[model samples]
Target: MRTTDTLNVIAANSRVLVGPLVLLVVLLLLFVFALRVGIGQIISLSKKVAESKVEEQVLSQKLEILKTSEESALPLADLSLVAIPSENPALIVISQLKNLAGEKGVGLSNIEAKQTAAVASIFHTEIEVTVEGEMGSLFDFLKGLGSISPLLTLDQVIIRQESGIAKVDALIFGNFAPLPTTLPSITSPLDELTAEEKDILAKISSYSQPVFTEVTPSGPFERVDLFNF
Candidate 1:
């Protein structure tokens, strides 16, 4: 009877522990699965970070190369010329006018500037200057103005002879575009324009001829000679 009671006690304790032990084992398995999922997420995030770093490095290298290329491509003056402002042209139109008037021994009387549309489809400003002078003075003025670098065009002329002074109205056109900032790869300034180009300019001058015509007496107009440059 004592041996049988001892065995029965042992069996009862084993049965009581079985349910708790099984529950503990299931919890451990769930914990292991959660750890594996967390590790995979961390690895994926690490790989993304590494890819981003590589992309950033490549972009930085490309930026450096572009910077170097820009530095070597052109000079500051060339850049400025290329980036000309529409409101103010690269060439100083007023300064050129003053120089031309000074060189020709002509006095500027009535100078007027009016913004006009450009035929080239680009927005531009045009100045119509009216100057009064003797015939000889006007001729000298025109010659000096025409001789300016980067050529000038005389567009119109209306002249009148009055009181021993020939009154003239001349319209001159100036280009707002700047001259090439980069000169030809030649040693001398004279080589900037080719012989062919010079010849072409000479022909143009011949075609334009004396930008002014002899005064006509038929118009009911003011005697003031309006010179537009």
Candidate 2:
């Protein structure tokens, strides 16, 4: 009878401990699962951070490129203002000359334009102008032409005084650049000006102005015949 009683007591103790052991096991499994989920979230966040860093670096590089482009654009804009387009260069020259002559109280008698041979990717256009004005006004007009756009070069000048008025025949040359099909590659923005370009600009600025001011024309001047040769 005592053995049977001891066996019953031991069995009852085992039943009580069984529930607590199962609960501990469940808690341990849940902790393991939560730890695994946390680890996965950390890894995903790390990957995102790395990708963001890479994108930030790429954006920085793009910003630098934009800065360089901005700097380069300024000089190119200045150059384009003086560069001649591939359009009707003769009309442009004639109009510019007529306006300049009228401003300086000069009379434009005739103008003739001829296209010369291309040299070094640049096309040359020759303009022959016959002008009559006072000697001082004629000199001033010639000087002002040097400072004008599309860059004129006075190849020859013949001047004679007729009845106290100067009659001048000038052979001027202008250049036009052909339109480029392919875009040029520019690596840096801080490029130096070429020697030839510097020299040309210097010459243009070195022209002397006349001591006295000539009266500008009040009305439109007489139109001169423009012939293409």
Candidate 3:
């Protein structure tokens, strides 16, 4: 009878311990999961910080270059824009051609200038020029075209020795690059101008730009707005 009582008490104690043991197991699992999540976040953040340090080094070099080259950059940029203008170069090209003809002692017999239509590449226009003069004068005029600005290129030329005339087909290039919508990333690589690029800049800088005459509109001489006047 005593043995049976002892067994019954032991069974009751075990039943009571079951709930606490299960609760402890659940708490342990939650603690482990929390630790894993915290470790993962810490590793990700550490990696980002390391990458940022490298980017910072690269950016520092670029900053130094910008500081040192600011003076030269402006003039080169201006020359580049003039070399490949952002607007229609038709008028300036025609003016240069006419001026060049006179300077080279050639008479402009017939001139036709047209902007290229939006067929494939609309970044250029075309001009047809006919000059009449001696062979030497025409040769000088042809040679001078490359030295003038608005970036003119003679694509086709036909010369008639007997008639003392030359028909020239030329292309005038323009730059219509759109402004950037977003700033570049800090990690973006900064490259110095290569030898070829520097050579191109030098050639472009040497090209002579046409003198533009701005026509200012005159106000009404008789004063149309009498009350205001």
Sort all candidates by lDDT, best to worst: 3, 2, 1
Question: Which ten residues in a row are the worst by lDDT in model 1?
Answer: 185-194
Candidate 2, 69-182: lDDT as tens digits = 565443454455344656446666777788788789989987999767577887778999988988889999988787666667798999988788789999988777777787
lDDT agreement with native, every candidate: 0.58, 0.74, 0.74
For model 3, the stretches where C-alpha displacement exceeds 4 angstroms are: 115-123, 161-186, 213-229
Which candidate leads in TM-score? 3
Against the true structure, candidate 2 has what lDDT?
0.74
Report how far off residue 168 is in candidate 2 (Å). Answer: 0.7
- Candidate 1 lDDT (Cα, 0 to 1): 0.58
The whole-model C-alpha lDDT of candidate 3 against the native structure comes to 0.74
- Can you give the TM-score per candidate against the true fold? 0.38, 0.51, 0.75
Candidate 3 has what TM-score?
0.75
Clashes of each: 3, 0, 0
Model 2: runs farther than 4 Å from truth?
1-82, 184-229
- Expressed as tens digits, the lDDT of each residue in 63-154 for candidate 1 is 66557545443233233332333344314555566667776666665555555456563434455665557778887776666555324556
